[model samples]
Target: MGVGVRVGVFLPAAGFPGMDHGEVLAAAVEAAVAAERAGFDDVWIAEHHFMSYGMCPSAVTLAGYVLGRTERVTVGTAVSVLSTCHPVALAEQAALLDRVSGGRFRLGVGRGGPWVDLEVFGTGLDRYENGFEESLDVLLAALGRERVSAEGERFRFREVAMVPRPARPMLPVVAATSAGTVRLAAARGLPMLLGMHVGDAEKAAMVEEYTAAAGDLGGPEVAHVAAGVAYVADTTREAVAVMEETLPRWLGPGLSGYRPVDGRPYVPKDPVEYAGLLCRLHPVGSPGHCADTMLTTIERTGVRHLILLVEGAGDPALTIRNIARLGAEVLPKVRASA
Candidate 1:
């Protein structure tokens, strides 16, 4: 509503049913370019390993690829699983992406999900909080051109200078948080990228707590508080159909590894049932309906940035068209009201 209510579209590089990996990756690059041309402000990619649902195991790498193709739209990892990758390497890749994108790169970091199968990669989940924090410290220090000497519980670094610092002295860092990670982000003075599935009540509380805590830390006011929600179609009925058809196959039990939330159930047996549940949290309807829902949510939550996960929609073409329509029709009205 603040005129800069950024509306972004998510590109799920791997999750589409029967989508060839190579073609899906290509579509992702194309989607970034299309989103930019369609007047979106930012494009986000996710990080998940060994999962058919999300092919981008390394968002930094995919971001680099997007950088080569798009010129104006900002590119970012919806999250880079910081607990699994070395901070120095992560910093280097981010710096390189910033360079390629000409300073249009933002960063989102988080503790890797439990379902990510870190054990197979010889990584332990114990001390994840420590590792996530230290990695952020190291990344920030490296970006600021300072030699880092970190000897924490999970990792040890000895006064090593990382080269090729980001073009921007302090790259925009958004810490991905839910109920569990919100306090951590506030403690570290980082902006937050709320996850895709939080309910309305929880989402509002998160924004309030984050803003208050960030103020107390004397940190820069949150640059953006972005929430991810699935956007399905041009009409409520059409949207319902898409969600009904796709949600079950994708959320089936065999794919439990894709979602790491504890005790969260997979998709419901009936599409209408799932649609009803998701609609409470996601914006899924016609352009006008979506606009109204989004505006109401933003007004209530004070969330400045909105990232719509159109990737789950059955048809990519429909998703792209809806995004363009949202940009042209929905955002302007919302901004006027704000």
Candidate 2:
């Protein structure tokens, strides 16, 4: 590994103030293009339903689109909601994407949010846990074999085969965060994706758990890829200023009652505490500061892949510029430190 760490960009497929739905999607594409040109490793698209919070209800579709538009840049779903689709269809589409992209596709799956997704998908929160397990079984089976069957609690399929099989022998599956989901990923020898909200201590504990769970029989030890907001500016003050203005929109009431991965009871925080925690845990500062924060995280924990949440960092121009600065000013220093 040249740097022992890889940096990816988390494209915002969600709402933005003054930006229309079409523009947000287009901006995400532009951001991916810029990130690739800026030497970023991969692009992960998000999935949401029935809310402006995240406009991309189909991360797989967006992944396919991005794959078609870019060369050499790996495209993945930050998560494609398993609860929302027929697993066989999802596997076929994902495989086709991989085939077309010449094996540069990754599949990241998550049990989706509880609000509009649950309401629209007609899945009560009660079923989410079991549904996720069942859906995952179907997805994994479909991806690995020509024909598969699953008599899962919520889903049952017989002799289903994914057409246009994946070009590569194996496509990487990255599981997003949840309390017990890390172990779930490890048991299958798959990697896990973490989010910004997880504090440093929790990340260390999670990584330890994954390492222990993946002992001995490892094909690859857990690929712990974490994501957080990042923007590079001439000064920390400028970066913080931009974040303060745009964060309210990104963290708006749409996420109210959102249950954290640790299963902690949701508690409203004072603005000061929130802002303080944001700076303490995330990279929202000058290019040098950004490099320092990333290096610190890599040192503290074994996280090697970071998906910089740059979609809402600023306007389209600023977001693009942040990618360039991170690639030029920050990446070298951070990688060199390795």
Candidate 3:
């Protein structure tokens, strides 16, 4: 049997200091194209609003652009925050992209933080806290059927047709951080996008929970996606040095930009410590080390797909090189082992 392993790149459109918004966006697009050139299977775009951490407020829109720029690789939204967006509207956009991209677009949705975006978008904190489930239900309904309507707590709308209906039913990838979200995805027969900061054991447990929940719903076989950092070099020390040098500069200001709408204290991580931790947890080393690390993660979590955050070097050229090196050097060993 063939090894069912897929590797993709995550482009955060990170708004690091010293680079303008245009530069950041251009870099993200460049990385996506390079990912395809490097033989990766997909490119996942991240969404954030009013934060230096990520400048892409509209991940679906960006996915469309990336789809236009690349031919073979699938382009997905790492997550379009569902709370601040109308589910139907996002679903329509996803459908449109799917048609235009020839079924290459995947919509990944998440419950964003209680940030000021809720107020700016007029979605309110209740939407962030209690409305995610309702929004997800509406999104799923809109994607699955041609004609749909919602009479839910947060949304009440008459039946409407999904114009330019999707050619194929699109199953969204849910970003799961806790049991509640994991169960939510599992019950819906959806795949979870596990986060980067989590360890293999934690991810394995979440997978177990999801499998158990899915078993109750007839045990459909699912392939979850694990997100992690990726950087490579001739030696482990060289790779670690590059990440330590570049990641902290971007992680600091980018992380500090979050503002809680409810006046809650929001403390960003210590960039230095967090970068070091990520280097340890992720595939940041020589080719052998990188492969071994990813193999362990795949084995422990039973996740067949991996979406790696590849901009740790904080430079467009270096990030592209990292993607290429990973595709050329690290992925072969990983594929062989799996």
Candidate 4:
């Protein structure tokens, strides 16, 4: 395990059964503020469009908002859906936030699902299926150099100077859920953001693949981030109970809302079963158990930075409390052992 295990919060801005978008977003901001106060290292915002699962449409915009609200913690998108966004425009926004936030902003981009977002954003289904690499290339170019142009199969443009250059050259963290994405990120010498749904073994496998693929680049060590659910209570039972009571109600509707643009047969996970799996996979227990679980994950995945999804309780106040406990109670133990 690494000498220091960095902890951060994942504010999904999840819209539970009865909550409105305003309330969801408010809870997210409150959680971010609470995580910072609790002494966590970062706050990562999740982006989802036109869904009750996650209400935030523009993660970069929300990241800017979170950055303005906190002074110390790093703020980033759990992922900004790259397939649905114009790479140059998103890079420009990332650079602006990086400049204003004093390099506290991290742009985490992913090839989002085959959803209606492509149609709504006017990027189309082909971009989601085949154009992500080109988009990523454009994004990297726009961020790496003062002037950029693209003459790719999907995008063609004349050169334009990057205005208001970032505090440093932007190196966005690419979200990797599959081999192709992992290889793409590794090829670019970019760090990866691994998803929460997988087990320790699976995450470790992804890390191994990334490490092998990234071996030849020989740059500074990449700080890969792992996302997981988090909850804390005096007893493991109490923590698990809370997650069981609330997570399914939130997950059921949210997971079912994704309309696959390719007309592929899509079967959403059974929310109750999924919630149980998350409880088993994540740190949903007493502080001691949570700390131990984190340590084990770190040892297995070789990933030192963790971004925990703290909204599993599906209540604003409880989510904030979870963040507080994670930072104040769980983080100390993890760090001490690390």
Error of 2 at 154 (Å): 1.8
lDDT of 4 at 57: 91
Overlapping backbone residue pairs in candidate 3 total 0
lDDT score, candidate 3: 0.91
Name the lDDT of candidate 2: 0.75
Please estimate how well model 4 matches the true structure, expressed as its whole-model Cα lDDT.
0.90
Give model 1 RMSD, 1 decimal.
Answer: 3.3
**lDDT of model 3 at position 158:** 97
If both were scored by lDDT, which would come out higher, candidate 1 or candidate 3? 3
Q: How close to the true structure is residue 35 of candidate 3, measured as C-alpha lDDT?
A: 95
Candidates ranked, most accurate by TM-score first: 3, 4, 2, 1
Q: How high is each candidate's TM-score? A: 0.88, 0.90, 0.98, 0.97
lDDT of 3 by residue, 124-227 (tens): 99999999999999999999898999888889999999887888989999999989999999999899999998989999999999998887652435878999
Which of the predicted structures, 2 or 4, would earn the higher lDDT when compared with the native?
Answer: 4
The predictions' CA RMSDs to the true structure, in order, are: 3.3, 3.2, 1.3, 1.4
> Tens-digit lDDT track for model 2 on 1-338?
24457889987475765778788888889989988898888999988765566778799898888888899788989888876677778888888888888888888887774444555567656446567777777778888897888776777767755687777665445555665787777777777788777766778777788778767633334567888778778999888887777766665643543444335466645444454567668788998899889888887777888888886563677788888888899888877885
Span of ten consecutive residues with least summed lDDT in model 1: 253-262
Kindly list the per-residue Cα lDDT of model 1 for residues 1-338, writing each as its tens digit. 46657777776574566767787777777778878887878899888787766778889888988888888888888888877777778888888877767898878777876543556555666536446666677777767775666677666767876667777765445555555567667776677777666655667778788766667762334665555555635587787667766666654532544543334455424534544676666777777777788777777776768777765564557566666776777667766775
Per-residue lDDT of candidate 4, residues 1-338 (tens digit): 23656889988799999887888898899899999999899999999988888999999989999999999999999899989988999989999999999999989999999997887778899998899999999999999998999889999999999987787977888999999999999999999899999989999898888888888862337888999999999999999999998999999999998887767789999999999999999999999999999999998888899989999888898898888888889899887887
lDDT of each: 0.69, 0.75, 0.91, 0.90
